[model samples]
Target: MSHAPHSPLPVGHYAYDEVDRTFLKQRVAQFRDQVERRISGALTEEEFKPLRLMNGLYLQLHAYMLRVAIPYGILNSGQMRALAQIAQRYDRDYGHFTTRQNIQFNWIRLEDTPDILALLAHADMHAIQTSGNCIRNVTADQFAGAAADEVLDPRVHAEILRQWSTLHPEFTFLPRKFKIAISGSPQDRVAARFHDIGLMARNGENGRPVFEVYVGGGLGRTPIVGVKLRDDLPEEDLIAYLEAILRVYNEFGRRDNIYKARIKILVQALGVDEFRDRVNAEFVAMDRARYRLDEGIVAAIRARFGVPDFDPAGQAAEKLAQQRKADRAFDFWVRTNTHAHKQPGYVSVTISCKPAGGIPGDVTSSQMNLLADLADQLSFGELRITHLQNVVLGHVRQDKLYGLWQTLEQNGLGTANVGFITDIVACPGLDYCALANARSIPIAQKLSERFASPDLQREIGPMRLNISGCINACGHHHAGHIGILGVDKRGEEAFQITLGGAADQDTVSIGQIIGAAMSEDETVDAIARIIDTYLARRTAGEQFIETCRRLGTAPFKDAAYATA
Candidate 1:
């Protein structure tokens, strides 16, 4: 069952054909002209802002940032190398991966952006809809086609949604930005419940994917779990149903206030039941037949994704166990980093971008190329970007796992604290983002150093500690089990703690404010104390979230303010 190294066919299902390549070239040419116009003083900054934004270019505090879309977080090694090339040539020698499973080049220049887009075109990638008020890049489970618990592959429908929403004349200018997440796995890996439209898709009796839709779910100043708008919706009707929701939100949604423009606000104002009624009304009246997903189209899209060849009886479970007994570090890595795959011999590996003291999702240009090469050698030339600011080799075999680990360690990519306390998700914060009120990276660095012990991290078990620089919740603090939100207090940076939020299928909830804002030092101390308190109180090996759910925030709050 031995496979050739870097085979001609990649395990990644989606391959861009002539049509997709043509579309990218055309888009790049258009952006190239726009960049020239802006450079030559023909287009004012104000005039060029929207055009640039439509292509995922942003004016950050220091410089222009370009966000390249990794649609559904799916891209191959070739695409990864393309990103590395962009980083090496156009901007800084590094790129920061975002919470949305996209990469951001923080030091981008306006003049070089057109060239960058043109280069991206060669790799069959683009930055379209990565910004603007449109339905932004659609995200699904990182282990979409491979998770052992998957009900059905959600990416087919994710790609379907991408096609349906991209430049759709109606949704191009909505009340505000909209986000949608889909999960085929019952375990919910992609944080489906926290999106604008969250869909939980399962296999139907007819083998077609059926979706349970959740609308108005978002986090920010107002963090709320989206409510289920519809149940058991056939795949064919998905686009139609979503269009209905968009139509309702676009028409009656608030146009006056920037803060109140999200679909969550609209859902709140109208109430969930009323909002559902409106969507249902639109669904019944619209041209449902025209919007229905055609079987031919679905088949074509699915065909683009080539299924990887897997060894049916090639698992080296005994060999892995023996190797685990030999090397403690490798064993520890295997314990936390690898996840179950649907294939017999393969396991999905999460490459921790969160080195103990390094930035959470920042990957160097060289590291990107190394990962690209590694993806080719071991993971069928495919890589997945996790929403938690990490990368995944979705189809790694159990036998070659040790070699992969060694190479990753040599290259400074082998931190094994995935899902542990040290794997904190944080935004760029005041360091790079103008919208940030406080420094998030420093706080994350402090926490990572404080809980650097592998034994301590294992003892704490799976923890979700998220930090946001402001009320915007870009770091998804509201969805973290132990959330720290930076707030302004008398011209000084302070943090507020929230407890008991969960972002999975088991329990979807927004974390509650446990206590008042505290200084940076106090915030880290509070998190440590909270973890220590959980160890004392948790009867079994219950995770931080489970403990938070069972024991309530009362105890954690006490520990947080125990000294204060």
Candidate 2:
């Protein structure tokens, strides 16, 4: 079948040229043959493993999981519907959104892989560079173009990196997997500091986008914050600076140990000064024009993501106050789930995927379909996937929020917890991932159930909780306000807790270990006790992290181990 897009796509997404379409079509055809070869035993499993992985297919504990890159987590309605269709037709009726802003179908079949790729291609999407030891997805702020405090929209830069890194010949097989996250806003919504290369966009003297480059930050076995390499690198030098960093890492990064393969290890060994010097030297020696990101090219790409024609008077706000007074639930939902938008009379609505008893970040096909419709109707035909594993309708009129929330509530999509305690971030753990030593989903589920009360969650206030099944830190436990790391103890799962970690740009930090490992039940109980202690000790308007900061982890630690 022709792999070309069967229908014209929505205009809100980053525009792809004819070359991109051709590349995707060719890749699908190549992978279709590879799948056929593997099935017929013409290729050994080991031989086919790399090929399958390069296409973003993985063999998990239960079934094959396909990780599809929503490049920078921006999705148009057509792309959203295509994902829903894939979930319904090729795999199970559900898909899971991951921390890196990719979507994974945990039940994809080997035989149906190519057809799924074909379906994705039909919507101008593909799964390339979603996996592998190469530079993975270039994640950016979900509210890049919409946030009120944004200094420079990171979407253009993110798209630049996306194009530059795809199948990059020199860096395809690095010492280990790499991640790069960029944020346009000063708020750092994308957790830029915890990524391999965190690019924080700022305005230059001339008021164009410059970057504050951070190198060697990652959260795995050795969780480390990236050190600032450049405070004010110009926009044209962005690509060149990144290339220099990668070249330095490619040469000096360790290959002897998988545990020490990340650039963080190299940076730690060399010290920040030495690493910075090497990267700068490399940058100076390289042919400058070969890697210069031209302004014309940048502008051309930015135009592809055309500006939204927001209504001057979005016919908004006049009815919102009345609706909030009419329905208390709507008010609560609005308080947490809605965010400030740059445009007047509009807001970005965060649709929480973490229901009281449901798995965090998992969405049903029906829900995806409805969200696609909602995106088309209320959010200007575009949707965004947040790093916290929630969906954002980034451009909704304030007047439409009540009706949108009502529709979401009827469909079980309105969980009313955006960043609350119940909105947990968790890896699939032993239930899905083969590398997991423990289960993260069940723990998250129990915690969500325990703190299921919206009233209780609101009382607790803005909290960041994360769980990792292993030290890989895919769930980013190290950067959470309250972090839980699951490990293998003697023959069973044991979880350890950490407190006072933060992920935002203002107060980014790694959590400190609170105590030794405990059973899943003990872990849940410990969390409850910690929360109870905070409730008793906190002053009015004190958030959880604020309480932890003022009193340190001593009281919370004592409370956690009181039962032991």
How many angstroms is residue 493 displaced in model 2 relative to the true structure, after the best TM-score fit? 1.9
Among these predicted structures, which one has the highest lDDT?
A: 2
Report the lDDT tens digits of candidate 1 across residue range 295-401.
88788887778777665545477778788899999999998999998888779999999988888899999999999888878788899998999999998888888
Per-residue lDDT tens digits for candidate 2, residues 260-312, read 99999999999999999999999999998998878898888888887776777
Compared with the true structure, the alpha-carbon lDDT of candidate 1 equals 0.88
Which 10-residue span in candidate 2 carries the lowest summed lDDT? Answer: 1-10
| Candidate 1 Cα errors over 4 Å, as ranges | 1-9, 205-208
Q: Residue 359 in model 1: shift from native, Å?
A: 0.8
How many pairs of residues collide in each model?
Answer: 3, 0
- In candidate 1, position 299 carries an lDDT of 82
